[model samples]
Target: GAGVSQSPSNKVTEKGKDVELRCDPISGHTALYWYRQSLGQGLEFLIYFQGNSAPDKSGLPSDRFSAERTGGSVSTLTIQRTQQEDSAVYLCASSFEGLNYEQYFGPGTRLTVT
Candidate 1:
């Protein structure tokens, strides 16, 4: 089965541009999550979708960061009007339902803003 995947392992952009990062999670997984990790920073939860409902969005840095999941499998995180401050390694993970389930992470998309 596919573990998880993210595209453009790296991305460089100028300020005020828009970029979209993609994530493909494993099949049969009903829980998915998006997170961002800045240099030397812990993983920050961006959004979480269990099935099709978003129950959390408290960690999104700003209005520029948004994400959506389709068919409960693939997800995309879009950053609009990029700023240098938005630079970070975006990580996506998926897990099984129930407690003590471990999340599998993708390689991550590193976005650099100039």
Candidate 2:
């Protein structure tokens, strides 16, 4: 199966705008995750979905950030009312299981909010 893939590799938007980032995880993988990385900073876990269970979204930085996984495969991360501090690379990853397993990451979507 193919590795995780993200669309709109780069995005530039004005502050207060909205953006949607998509991710297609490897076929059959049951766990998907979203993360954000600001310049010179470590990856920040955003959200995660595993199997048919409820998604873990406690990592989301604010109420404006949300995500969903459809049919347990493809996922989307939405940032509402984007802020300049939100500028960073949004990364998607997946594994056969949850964080306990080896995870594979996609080429992150770089977002710039000015």
Candidate 3:
């Protein structure tokens, strides 16, 4: 793809449900990132995967959140036991080799936990 792409542009789930969001980065991009944005708040970094290095999961808000990248291209974020606070827009971005890290972002999946 010419740019990053994400699945299920919108998702609505009940509290305590588990949700999985998917992302496909631009071909050859070596870095992938997951973030979340709540209303009137800044983007919260969730996870990062670059090349073969260990994924930087320092940004995950809680143990209920997890993500992985396969083949250094596709990524998925899973949120377990979702809470109302989990309602937010989940974003994915990609860059090549972190050169100033000008990332290309996908249309985020808006999650509504009710």
TM-score each candidate: 0.94, 0.94, 0.94
The better-scoring model by lDDT among 2 and 3 is: 2
* Alpha-carbon runs more than 4 Å astray in model 3: none
Residue pair clashes in candidate 2: none
TM-score of 1: 0.94
The whole-model C-alpha lDDT of candidate 2 against the native structure comes to 0.90
Q: For residues 3-47, could you state the per-residue lDDT of candidate 1 as single tens digits?
A: 889988999999999999998888887888888999999998898
lDDT of 2 at 45: 87
Clash number for each model: 0, 0, 0
Instruction: List model 2 lDDT by residue over 19-103, tens digit each.
Output: 9999999888898888999999999988888864545668999999988878888888999999999999999988898556888
lDDT of residue 89 for candidate 3:
99
